[model samples]
Target: MTTTRTADPTAEPGAPSTTTQASLYQQLRAHLAVLRLYDAAEHLPAVLDAAIAEGLSMTAALERLLAVEVDATEARRLAGRLRFACLPTPATLAEFDYDAAPGVDRALIDELATCRYLESATNILLIGPPGTGKTHLAIGLVRSAAEAGYRTYFTTAADLAARCHRAAIEGRWATTMRFYAGPTLLAIDELGYLALPAEAAAAIFQVVSQRYLKTSIVLTSNRGVGAWGEILGDTTVAAAMLDRLLHRSVVLNLDGDSYRLRAHQARNETLRKTTTGTRKPLS
Candidate 1:
């Protein structure tokens, strides 16, 4: 007697059986969805192809997939932080014109860029005349801090003072103060641009007191320390705030003509020489 074999019921006539393969794909998608690995799930096929083509081990393939997901997640997080920071512009140390601002200490600025001062809650005070790149330096350092994974904030002294005053009136001063102090690095620019009233002066002092020794600060001012009392309109408050800030601060006084003015003059001279083949006499 001859025995005859029967075909599998799950197999098709001209196609390989794919029940196990389909089941695995479904299970993978479900797990990835549950774990919120959308990016990895979307790129799974391509990455798998690459891995297989490269003869990667199972462990190596997993690492490659996870690395892509991790990188995407970190990029999104950094973008969110930068948006929340509200930096005037995206400034970096590389874009800074070190040659134009000779007064600034390149070595010190570079060291600060490493974000070591933040570990110790040290303050940085950029004192300079108008257009001497104080604001640029402050923004650069704050950007650096943010890139280094530190929470950072940027606000002008006038704006901060106004916010604090409003919060006080609304009985939300504590909450607002906490928000300002929460950042790892808070950069307050144009400190002496507008003279503060007594209430604003007090508000400024409260913020400084709250964050003193707790977080780092990068302050840019066009006024000297002695003039702060008059600018803030409260001698005692100014003294106290300065005492706290200056105690552990790195002070840099930028002494030079305004960078903006110099740039403007250079442009004008170029234009004059171009228009009429003669140099314009300086006043």
Candidate 2:
């Protein structure tokens, strides 16, 4: 025995045709499916009507109904430029000894969530051996700061030098410096991995010197502090650059076996993927 219902004169245009209980269930299912809730949300009247007819808990029904809606709103909250979303959570978990430093306290990781130093224009330096989470920490902190309403820009020391060289040739060196220096926190990774030319060294020094007390920066490098002079290839310029950078900086020294080296030896390593691209294990 089926009952038919007439359409209301005030129904909205393009509204689903719901002339029967079955039709109403079908419309609801279609609406919910548009939001992608497909676990038994088929166009079946008995499924929905039975719940309502049996006086099931409305609270429970509404909870199930709005699951997708809550997830969508949360996804939008994490909307910031990310360098590498593929960074495994294991890197940030407590298993990593994030607190093994003096000035570079892991305690700051919690404090930095509020972006105080970034707001105050202080720089952070993560000095460590290769594959000891220098890049990971820098990227993580940049993501944290960016999510807290600060703009973040990431580049390697090599690419930065290359771009600066290009800008110099094009007579826009200052423009390029401002481009990278504009971010609330600029994450410059691998500062000493590749050798840099003299002019690139000076331009980089100029940028660092200018940002002193004016903006925040985060750098990760595999080279030791003494070797930086060699990497820059100009002892005088390197000294001056360090003067400005180390004035009020939090310096982190990471000392350990290369996590990368350990993984390669065991053959248990997985290639880490980044937004720019994927790289195989570096020897």
Leading candidate by lDDT:
1
State every prediction's TM-score relative to the real structure. Answer: 0.89, 0.64
TM-score of predicted structure 1: 0.89
Q: Could you say which candidate leads in TM-score? A: 1
Per-residue lDDT of candidate 1, residues 1-283 (tens digit): 9967465776532222367765776688689889999988777776777776899898988888888899889888888878878999887886888888887789999999999999899999999899988999999998888888888999999999889988988999999999998999999999998876568888888888999998999999999999999889888988999999998999999978888899999999999889787656779
**lDDT comparing candidate 2 with the true structure:** 0.70
Which regions of candidate 2 fall more than 4 Å away from where they truly are?
Answer: 1-80, 83-105, 268-283
The CA lDDT of each predicted structure is 0.87, 0.70
lDDT of 2 at 72: 54
